[model samples]
Target: MAASGAVEPGAAAATAAPSPAPAQAPAPEHLFRPISAEDEEQQPTEIESLCMNCYRNGTTRLLLTKVPFFREIIVSSFSCEHCGWNNTEIHSAGRIQDQGVRYALTVRTQEDMNREVVKTDSATTSIPELDFEIPAFTQKGALTTVEGLISRAISGLEQDQPTRRANEEAVAERIDEFIVRLKELKRVASPFTLIIDDPSGNSFVENPHAPQKDHALVITHYNRTVQQEEMLGLQAEAPEEKPEEEDLRNEVLQFNTNCPECNAPAQTNMKLVQIPHFKEVIIMATNCDCCGHRTNEVKSGGAVEPLGTRITFHITHPSDLTRDVLKVTKNPFTLGDSSNPGQMEKLREFSQKLDQILEGNVKAHFIMNDPAGNSYLQNVYAPEDDPEMKVEHYKRTFDQNEELGLNDMKTEGYETGLAPQR
Candidate 1:
């Protein structure tokens, strides 16, 4: 193959051989030969090709080069002289690596953003500080810099809608602000981390703090997740797909447990239910056939929602009981008398009190605090400006954060004149 080079060698002239059987040498496969030298400078070779966009004749230049902490790479560039269009691609000259690779670099300055990165199609890029991630499926592999990656993400951010599902537009605006901050990092020294995780092991980031100590960079090896392996077609066998019914069935073994209300031995039933958009939940219940008493509740599937939610309703009249109310809980509760003789009396009494509140004899407030956005309450009678009854929805609070297991942040103490010695 011809390479992008300054000098083109001419065809060798055949010299007449005097020997009876002339010694022959095979022709070279490449148009431009690679030469070894102390400086190790190689020439680029140019070849003619069709324009990818316009389909017109163009010239493609190929150059072989080495990068800092990476093997040889082929730089292939195309320029259509007729259409004034051009593009470039980089390919590794080395074999596929064995293990998945993760490259992380702390970008502290504008110069740090300029460091080169070779990303493959199987790579996912992320910036934890910005809460931004570019999934492998959504991005194309490219030889770019940290700044280039951030710029591409910014472009995608601008395409989000001005209005979206409740709270989505606000989120997009926040992302826009974050992208602007990233752009400002190009002119300032704000520190951030750039990470590239590739399952195919075809991606690389310039490492300046390695054996050569060219820059501050860290490289790590990791095993790919099942999903990642499947995405990269590295799975040796396809995973079995369980039937929907099988997933819905509760496989828990029945156990004898005492009822919290009656302190009587009861059988407990537990199973997992997959909730759409919300998450999986474990529905558990216990019933005392003797007392006709039953209790049920739900537990979350172990994922935290992005924000907390609060719901409140006021019961002012008997008509409010007729209004539709949706209460989706793992545990199902009822406000009624029980036929079982062993049923707990406190639960029966509470049921009666709830009925009294619904009858308007005792005005009460119904409130539900859920961070997972899994519960709902409807207010069909209230108008937009209703004064007597109102529905309030607000963001999650610090206490909610604590409940969701995300409130572990610790800040440094402010120094004062207080003595430190005991």
Candidate 2:
């Protein structure tokens, strides 16, 4: 070795036995904390990786767990036995939400600063009052408290300050002044605003008074811009112009969603479907690998029509009751009379007829009403129409919309500042 600590040209000729491996150091058990009865199912998966601190092989354990009142997340804990340094981070394990979410919190008290926050890697955190921001992708996502987040920012701001003070005195002094403002935010001096904008809609801030409106916190949702879409890697490529009929068959689009029953991450396959003599609609189907659950929904252009929800509800009911609602497809004959006794007898008659269709050699018509006009029952025999099978779209009545809880959202007196909850 030279005086300046440069290695000699023949240093490769030197040989020595490597040091023995250190005893494995375990990570804190808090990363796998039990938040629910199913927590035992979430075992941590370990992977060997190079530790950032020691540049040596270390273990990284990842556990997928569900957070109460929130969603699923994967907690990662890394430990290096050689350096005795460990770090933990959390990543969202749930599906991306439909719309972007923005949270603006007014931190007024110490309790406010203690509020929990789930900031995803794609989320942007900013203190508007100080004009400071931690841009998206600049820091790893975390499950932490507001005070803990501020302390982390302070540590980052003060990192390598001694060198800066020695070499860049003026820049160091300005940074010192900024650090004081960050400390004041933690002290809740005159209150400050903390904002988190997540285009992926995965970030969240706790509401101490959950189920009740929190005046100190404001949450809003909006669609993401084109630039935001590109940043998120969700931007779809421009399609080549072609005939309208060829648009759907050209590609099968897949989107990420969640299983309705288990809420596990799932993928939804979608393709445009055309019903003869009707408008085109998109059909999406989800099959969960975690749980043996499957769901399919149809959309004409906007929202998912209510027919799917009705089908889901009917499947939950017993046979007799399900037959009553499902009679739209099985039996079209009306049950006579509005009186309770007569209706009961009519329902009894309908049930018996349905059993007859199932057991006897009776041919019954199968008529389906899809609100999005996505159903197709092609007529065979050249151009001949099939009278037994019909596919149709019907206008949902106002009462049906009310049954869907959509009509109940209307506020007639919102200008008066008070609208009663329905």
Candidate 3:
């Protein structure tokens, strides 16, 4: 065989030096160069994309968690490391499988897990921004349906038919002027929500439509007091009086009585006595004989009751006299069929004074206790200390008196008052 182009193995291998391989002619400058404006413009802009399964192909994927309700569509360009290829994927709402089910399950599970994890982590996520606007509803002219009309009426916006017609021409002129003004300003206005509170503390909220120019009038209606306005004319005016009018008026009053205990030319002194026991005041007069003796005993000539050792006055407004008498009988201090005579008298006197001041529109009553002791005038009610009368003991006495009618009790009362006709 002729010399074959093959080297003999292990036959003194030729020690020939090997030539160096050529250096990669420094990669063309353009190959490693920064992008040019022209090239960039021609090149498709790179976008990050993600694969749902891997979730790692892109630099970063937008988490569309904030707007989950809206379809989450992420447009990204990803270079697949495993396949050595580049492509774009749009993970849209439709691409998401079992979205509803996954959302429900994952949201609940993730929320619970996140709550636990967040407790340990100090990082706080920012809240999503909400961009929303409320719609404006404004209408001019009469509303169409009955519901619309009713709503307008309740809000005090709709005027009566006659009033509306009467003011139509004027209102039209005003509306034209308003429209012109509004056009000049280039603004849209809505109905005012009028909030009003009444004297009774009830509040109302209403939306009333009127020209913005007429809003002042609408607000005035809310500020007006209907009930108080009606009474403005009827309110009483203060009366001017002379300085000594009260004293002169009191000095002219007279009473007829004699101290039966001393029988020594008695003079009666009237006073307005306030009773703390009953929370009332009475016009009571006592007769003093100037011999260290006094008595409220008296003879009745007019509507007044007979002389009692102790007298009391009941005062009340004239308008309340009848009602008070009926109420007093049912009061806690009533003695048998009658109320406390002293308290009743005081109520009567108070009522009388109120009647005089109110021109018979008020009334009062009067009562009296022992005039000798200051207890009656001092607001101290002690039935045990009085020999002639014992309110505390009268409960037992009146129980027996109930057996005797008024006529029978009067006969017994005449016997107790006489001094043997000496």
Candidate 4:
């Protein structure tokens, strides 16, 4: 055996330390080479760099540009000759915001989908009508149009869930159908809602009706929950458990109610929840243990306001049908069971005419009369100069208020809220 500290004469060469390789100069900041005006103008400053994938030298181009509505951004494009790898990325110079924003619009026409949108990585998108949603963490933001956003979503699903499509033909077909419908929405053949909820507030939807308050776009700012803040690396305190969500064993109220469908006693569960902007609403739900019957209803617990209001909107395009129109009225303004027969007949005629407007068969007016002043027609923002669109607000008359039971009733010598006649 060889001595522990001894090396053979021929082994000296094999054990020698190799010389350190010379360091390579850092690649130029810009991919193209910059040329002076005297030599050749508009020459690109090309920079040779190693391919990120194959670790070989590659050519890259970096351009700094200020895009309209997007501020300044660095657009970097690179291509590798070794492995044929090409990549492009855009970096925004804008500062990241602490609070998030949400932009929602009803896409009803081809023009609506063409509006430019800027989405950041820290944004979540969803189309509730299609039952599709994408989380923020999974997205790398892009400045694209509404149609581009849908295309990106379809491409991602196809790439990420290859096995799912191969194994389940039915599921794959369903996804294909959904993709077709998504494309149709871009062509104005179908209407759908596009919602972008960004916790980073870096997403934007171009105002279709600019320089005016009336537009179909809505911008809402929401507070992030503790869990959401933590996910976004924001400083947040540990949230305390709410009493309602705590274990039922420690609760005092009886949740088991009766099933309305099956008439089963104590077979239902009820809960009252307060929605944002809207007041308390009771959700009564029950599943029958004997018959498997289920039933549920949502009822508002808030009182109706006294004032009455009227709203009107013009329908010029098929997309206008998708606008949310809410009519809130008291018993007198509404055609209910207590309404006179003639009033109900007139309401029926009105409803038929309104249906015609929604069908785009007529460029008629959409008038909503609410005696309670608690109704809204969201995103009816057509400019006054728009020939095809208009919005009008009307105040309720005293007689209308009286019919709605919102006016004071007078007796022989007394009025409502006054002392009775002696």
Name the candidate that leads on lDDT. 2
TM-score of 2: 0.53
Candidates' TM-scores?
Answer: 0.41, 0.53, 0.14, 0.44
Cα lDDT of model 3 overall?
Answer: 0.28
lDDT of 3 by residue, 1-422 (tens): 11111111211121121111222222122222122343432233343554333445443222211011122222333354653443322222111111111010011121122111100001111101111111111211110222222232222222232354476867545434433432322121322111121221111112111111322222222222344333222233356554363553345345454443323345666443334442222344565535455434322212212322344444334432332222222222222232335555665565455446446544434444432222333323342343322332112244333322332443333657864332
User: Once all C-alphas are superposed, what RMSD does model 1 give against the true structure?
Assistant: 29.3
Show model 3 residue runs off by greater than 4 Å.
Answer: 1-155, 158-231, 235-238, 242-422
Q: Report the CA-based lDDT of candidate 1 relative to the real structure.
A: 0.58
Q: What is the lDDT of residue 386 in candidate 3?
A: 30
Q: Per-residue CA lDDT of candidate 1, range 259-294, in tens?
A: 543334579987877764345777888887554568
Error of 4 at 341 (Å): 56
Badly placed stretches (over 4 Å) of model 1 are 1-41, 155-178, 212-216, 235-422
lDDT of 2 by residue, 285-380 (tens): 999887668877776744545443111111111221323233422221221221134434555666677666655445454445544334444443
Native-referenced Cα lDDT, model 4: 0.57
lDDT of 1 at 89: 58
Candidate rank order under TM-score: 2, 4, 1, 3
Q: Which tens-of-lDDT digit does each residue in 1-422 have in candidate 4?
A: 11121111121221111221221222222322222233243243366776656677778665543343334444455677777766544444444454678888888878788887777666778888877777665655466789888777666555534665779878767666766776666677767788999876667787644323436777777777777777767677566555654343243334554443223444545566655443555666766665476766665545555455566777787787775443222222233232345545555666666666767888867677776655545543332244543334456688776655555754344545666655
Clash statistics: count for each candidate: 18, 0, 54, 12
